[model samples]
Target: MGTREEIAFDRALGALIGGALGDAMGMPTQLLSPAEIKADYGFVDCFIDPAPEHPVSKGLKAGAVTDDTEQTLLMASVLLQSGDSFDHHAWVNALVAWEKDIKARGGYDLLGPSTKRAIDAINAGTPPEEAGRSGETNGAAMRIAPVGILVPPGEALIARVAESCRATHNTTLAISSAAAVASVISHGIDGADWREAIGFAVAAARAGEKQGHWVPGGTIAARIEWALDMVEGCSIEEGIARVFDRLGTAVISQESVPAAFAVLKLAKGDAWEAAVIAANLGGDTDTIGAIAGSMAGACAGYDRLPQDRIGGLVGIDLDDVRELARALVRARLTDEKARHG
Candidate 1:
């Protein structure tokens, strides 16, 4: 076995790559129902080309990622450039530039509803803080694995996630959702199994709900437990179906985030299996797949991922992810040493 630092670095890289792999795997089936997905590609266990009629991902080759991976890379880039200091203005600027770049490249980018509105408002000179107050979607949660890589789990993780999410998902549910995903990834990087990580994820969700603008919905923390509890004894197929039908798979933070965790539970922390389940899961497939993938990959480590998909991902840099993961761990270690001293 590797040393603790070596393990953290590998798990951090695994989280990023697994997110991209699942994003690509689910891209074609993103908005389609399970019936629709089955009609088109059957199981969706591997990378396949998006259909010509695909709403968001047509004209791209197999293994091409969608907005989920793009925004994740965007968050990673900003975090790396700024180090421990976060600049809201700079982050907004990056979002604007990303959209502009997308438009320039033929306008096929699938920005989520909350993110699109926040970006438009920010471009029109609204303060980023106020612009996202009403936002409540999984957009924040879908791309927050980078924050997990940067911080260890605890109050610091929750606070950092709030800052990253405030620009596009400022509502209580949204922040809590992101916190759950990030918390899982953080704990996983520290070598916790899904059994231990889920408890921490629930704690983080509760803490995060206290950060953003208050909104009334089923508590994210409660739904995570509820979603997992309902699917406890069932087989993989039954669990995924229960999550899809009962827990939901919509873009709402409450639905999709819990759905991701449910898939993770059924997949038992296997990155490849989680991706397969999430890819075929129907609504918000790419985001759900990416979220589950990050957590599972981090806990399971790099060796457990699908090598074919790792080599197949398009428009992503594995080498860059490797370097970024190392840097993030180094930064975290420095922070810990300073704090203890």
Candidate 2:
């Protein structure tokens, strides 16, 4: 591979591992307020086992990841498995199979509200295009890094994001959030500066908001800009505090997605820093951390992450996505026609 291709490959793998890192780091803290996180874990700088009372993650290990990483990897696998055709049935089947595996392992039920509702809708005979008409949550955006890795920003990325969202997160806010996250990753893989990648993400959000069925919410692009502006010039602690209080850290697409962008800025695009910050930011911490970590990884590549933190991400066997990450970069590098809509 040439220099550019090699770089892309590294960033793609970085996105995968970075995602797992953040997901696992935040697994134990989800649903707590920032104060609660501080009180319980005394600032989550590393992976710690979930509190016994954590509804979904209590039974898992310190470095265990939740549905954010699982769904992202599952989407990546389905994207590759479906080849050029985007087999809808295959996608749904993959989700179903994943859900089953979680159950068999006695893993806590981790499907986000939007995902569960959409799947239920589809199983009840809702049309694919309509099943997720009301899904305006973070579920779609959390699993969208693969699209970013495989497709360039602009119309192609928007179209691919639309396809990725249609069956489970079809609403405007949800699609826009996913596009924003994916665009940042895509631009990072393409060698854009971190701030430049955020610009690309805003543009992608604008484009993506037009694709899915309309839903009432603040414009995702505008929210991202507001988020960055709100935290500009703040120290890391102040930035995290401002984001947690003002921007929110909930599951709504408007809240969590933009909060992630803000986290990326605060961390200066360091995957390890981003994960640390997001893990302590409280509600929906895992997804927020995962998104920021994915973008940071895409911007800087796996080599840039801290060596110590890498050892803690063992619960998710990141080797599973290493080869897949390379294949994605290959698709992007060759201008593969198979990637086209």
- Global CA lDDT of candidate 2, please? 0.87
TM-score of 2: 0.96
Instruction: Give me the runs in candidate 1 sitting further than 4 Å from their true place.
Output: none
**CA error at residue 243 for candidate 1, angstroms:** 1.2
Candidate 1 per-residue lDDT over residues 117-176, each given as its tens digit: 988888899888877887889999999998998898889999999998888888899999
TM-score of each: 0.97, 0.96
Every model's Cα RMSD, please? 1.3, 1.9
lDDT scores in order: 0.87, 0.87
**Residue 26 lDDT (model 1):** 84
Candidate 1 — number of clashing residue pairs?
A: 0
Model 1 TM-score (2 dp): 0.97
